[model samples]
Target: MLPLAGERKNAKGIIFEKAYSRNISRGTSTLKRGFAHMLKNGVVMDVTTVEQAQIAEDAGAVSVMVLDKLPSDVRKAGGVARTASIRIIQEIMDSVTIPVMAKCRIGHVYEARVLQETDVDMIDESEVLTPADEHHHIWKWDFTTPVVNGARSLAEALRRIEEGAAMIRTKGEPGTGNVAEAVTHIKKVNDELRAIKAIYDSGDNQDLIRMAREFKVSYDIVEQTARLGRLPVVNFAAGGIATPADAAYLMSLGCDGIFVGSGIFNANDAKERARAIVLATTFWNEPEKVKEAQKMIDERQSMLGLDVNTLELRMQERGGSA
Candidate 1:
């Protein structure tokens, strides 16, 4: 095993353990966190083909997530949605200089192994795809490649982080083209964080232990989160973001970045909307700039959005609430 720059190896240490353990050398884990940090305030577009991947790169996307089906199509078709074809993932990897990510069914270790071998920069243990293991998620520490997972609350986010997820995205009702669920999830996390922070400020270690037990995560992880006052890793907004305004709105809600899937290719103006969403996310704090991005596309030509309430399946709920 290759030793991380400052990581001293214990012969008995977990193989590849430097990848995620916060208790290990801070430098190693911080390096992984920094990779995601570089994409902060940027947009990560989902692409199915090399052409679309190139378009996303051209539009200033920080990264592109390669997937077999748009979440909406995954919902519409109603079958087991798996990882992208390796051929397509490789083609997209060849096509873009920016980071390339691909999704794996939740807990699908073999699929994730295949993606890691494909040399993709990141892996999303995505709920947008069908779940491969109902009771457990992949043990991400076993791999060298970084992983991102979805969460709806602080407890869920902390659990994924403990499981070695390098990043987190809200598991909003995907493919619906609605932002409400995303907003709700982010707020739920934020509210819980605030509560934990308050408990920390009160100097109540016992209360924190209670919280750790309640969240079913490590006490150290909860304590560290309270110390940082946010997720230790990057947190991005995803699922159902269909417009530039939707992207900016999530940024304002404190996500480090945004992930837009069906919102782009499924629309009438892929190029324009793609560019607009990138601009919106980057300048999310600037209201005037957001308005400019909002005006870049014709709303009539946007994807016919579905209401979250009307959807028969909520992709966000697939991973059993954690």
Candidate 2:
């Protein structure tokens, strides 16, 4: 069963009123696909296991990311799942048809191959909490199954898409335990894209390339990413997403969706947090709601180290293994 609306203590030591989203519809926008219709009114919920995944689906997440294992725990435990157990993977898939995504270590094609046999909808060459076989970019063309890889910058995002990734992400690192890094990265990419567009529209073609490069998009994807203001998925702003405002903020950035990792399950008020975050996406443009939701997050939210450079290096180090 999914996580029910459980009672919990709050500032006044009173049980907080709780509710969960039942889907997103008639929201600020509908989730879009490609450059246009990627699950616009979508949101992602990350779960450590199958039980929580079912809960997320029940609570209205458009999709659920089920980790093979959690990095937060693995940082304490010594090892990682070379591959998520087939039984556990199948359990989650069985529980929900709303796009169950399973993560595997980078370059661990065997794990992905196995997940494919189970009929998963997509593969997230994830580098978050329990990353394995990390790679600079997942080989999208190599897999028959569609992939969603992390992009710290637009260049990486576009390159992955160009390489055949069905979806591209902002690479909001997993288990950073803080939202600031994700926020900063998201802002940088968006700001850079905006600047590039401004310069391009100004007819400064010579400098536009250099400027777009700053945001991380390659020459080809600049045309594509710039064609649309938002990303291609159900763009799920992940990582330190912990509260309703956090989810709302991503929506404000034109994100199609928000992906909550441990944030939902770890919140002091899990059900309320989930409900609020779920509702926030729908009411994203509302100033009063954003004000009310902002208070839920702590001012000191921070993220740990996850230099994509280092991850790229790690991915490169395994070149011979592949």
> Which of the numbered candidates is closest to the native, going by highest TM-score?
1
RMSD of each: 4.8, 13.1
Instruction: Give the Å shift of residue 252 in candidate 1.
Output: 0.8
lDDT of candidate 2 over 1-322, digit per residue (tens): 1111111112121222334643322111111123223445666776767778877777777777777555444434554445566788788888887887777666566677777677766677766534554444555555545566666665555555555555655656555445565676678668756865666567666676775556454554564455454443434566767667777877787666777776776555655566667778878899688666655544443223344433422221222122
Candidate 1 lDDT: 0.86
When summed lDDT is taken over every stretch of 10 residues in candidate 2, the lowest stretch is: 2-11
lDDT (Cα, tens digit) per residue for candidate 1, span 1-322: 2112212123211343355545454224455556788888989999998999999999999999999989888888898999999999998888789999999999999999999889888899999899999989997766667789999999998888877777889988888888899999999999999999999999999999999999998788888798767888889999889999999999998999999989999999999999999999989999999899999999998888888887788888877565
Each candidate structure's TM-score, on Cα atoms with residue i matched to residue i, is 0.92, 0.72
Candidate 1 clash pair list:
none
